[model samples]
Target: MGDDAPAALVEIVRRWADDPSLLVQRAAVAAICEPRLLKAEGAAAVAVDLCGRCTLHLVGLPLAERAGSDARTLRQALGYAWSVAVAADPGPGLGAFRDLDTSDPDVGWIVKENLRKKRLARLL
Candidate 1:
C-alpha cells in the first residue's frame, strides 16, 4: 500500500498548477528527478530551498518516520514525486489546462487518487 501522501501530493500539486505559488512550485521541482527536466533551471528555480526538504520527504525522511519497509513503496513514492514536478511543466495534459489559479474545485480528490494509482503502476 502507498498510504496517503502520494495522493495528497498529487492533489496539492494540482491545486498549485493552477496557481503556481512559490511553495507549490518548489515542491514540484524537488519531486522532479529527470536530468533533462531539472536542467531547465528556470522551471525549478522558483523553489530551490523547498526542494531539499521535499526530496527528503519523497525519498528518505517519510520512510524513516514510518519505518517504510517496501522498496516498491519507496519507488512508487519517487515516481509520484517526479509526476508532481512533471505535471507542473507547461506541456501535455497539464499545459492544456488553465493555470493552477483557475478554480476547478470539481476536479476533486479522485484525480489525486488516480495519480497515485498511476505512480504505483510504475513500480509494478
Candidate 2:
C-alpha cells in the first residue's frame, strides 16, 4: 500500500475534486495523508496536484471558515495542504501565497503558518 496508496487515495479525492461543497473535507483528508506519500514512487505529482487544488480552494474562500469544518480542522488542513504544495516544488501552484495579502486574518495567519512550516521542511 505504501508504494501505490497515494494514487489510489488520490482517485478517491478526485471523486469530489469538482465539488466546491465537499472540497474542505476532501482536502483535509488529502492534506493529512499526502505528505507521507510524497516520497512514494510516482506519488509526488498526484499529491502535489491535490495540494494545489486544495490550496486554490482555500485561496478562493473569503475566509477559512468557509471551508466549513469546526474551526481548528479548517485551519490545520489548509496549513498542511500548503506545506505539501511548497515542499513539492515551491512553484506558483502553492508558492503563490508568497505574493498575496488576503484581507481575511485567518487566511493570512494560516498562509504565514504554512510558509513557516515550509521553511522548517527545507531546514530538515
Candidate 3:
C-alpha cells in the first residue's frame, strides 16, 4: 500500500510524459515525481522534452503547483532537466524548448529566470 502510491505516480508520469491530451495530468505527476524521476533512468530527458512539447499555458502550471509542490522545487527540477536535455543533444533538446511563450505571468517569470541563468553562464 505504501509503495503503491509512489510507484503508481511514477508510472503515471512515465505513461503520460508526451501525451498532449493529458498534459495537465502528466505535469501534475511529473512535478510531484521530479526529484525522484530526475535520478531515474532516462526520466529527466523524457520529462524535459515533454515539458517543451506540451502546451502548458493554462492547466499544467496551476495543476502542478496545486499538487503540493513548491516553486523552488519545480524551477530546480525543470532547470536541471533542461540542462541535461541540452547536454545530451543541443539541437533537438534545446530547439524543443525554444518556442515556449512567455505569456502567463508565472511561466513568463520562470522563462525569464532561466534566460537570466543562461546569460550569466555565458559571461562566466
- The number of the candidate with the highest TM-score is 2
Q: Model 3 over residues 1-124: C-alpha lDDT tens digits? A: 1133655655566556545444354354345334444454554465455556433523365655534544444444454344444444444545665666667554565455555555323422
- lDDT tens digits by residue: candidate 2, 24-71: 555534543455666665455555555445545555676546646644
User: Which pairs of residues collide in candidate 1?
Assistant: 17-100, 18-99, 18-100, 18-101, 19-100, 19-101
lDDT of each residue in 7-100, candidate 1, tens digit only: 4444454454333233444434434433344444343332222332343433333334433344334333433444444443424323322222
RMSD of each: 15.7, 4.0, 7.2
The lDDT values for all models are: 0.36, 0.56, 0.49
TM-score each candidate.
0.24, 0.59, 0.45
* Sort by lDDT, top down from the best: 2, 3, 1
For all candidates, the clash counts are 6, 0, 0
In model 3, the Cα lDDT at residue 32 comes to 37
The local lDDT score (0 to 100) that residue 32 gets in candidate 1 is 43
- Candidate 2 regions off by >4 Å? 20-33, 58-68, 92-94, 99-101, 118-124
Worst 10 residues of 1 by lDDT: 101-110
The model with the greatest lDDT is: 2
Scored by lDDT, model 1 comes in at 0.36
- Stretches of candidate 3 off by over 4 Å are 1-13, 16-47, 53-72, 117-124
lDDT of 3 at 22: 44
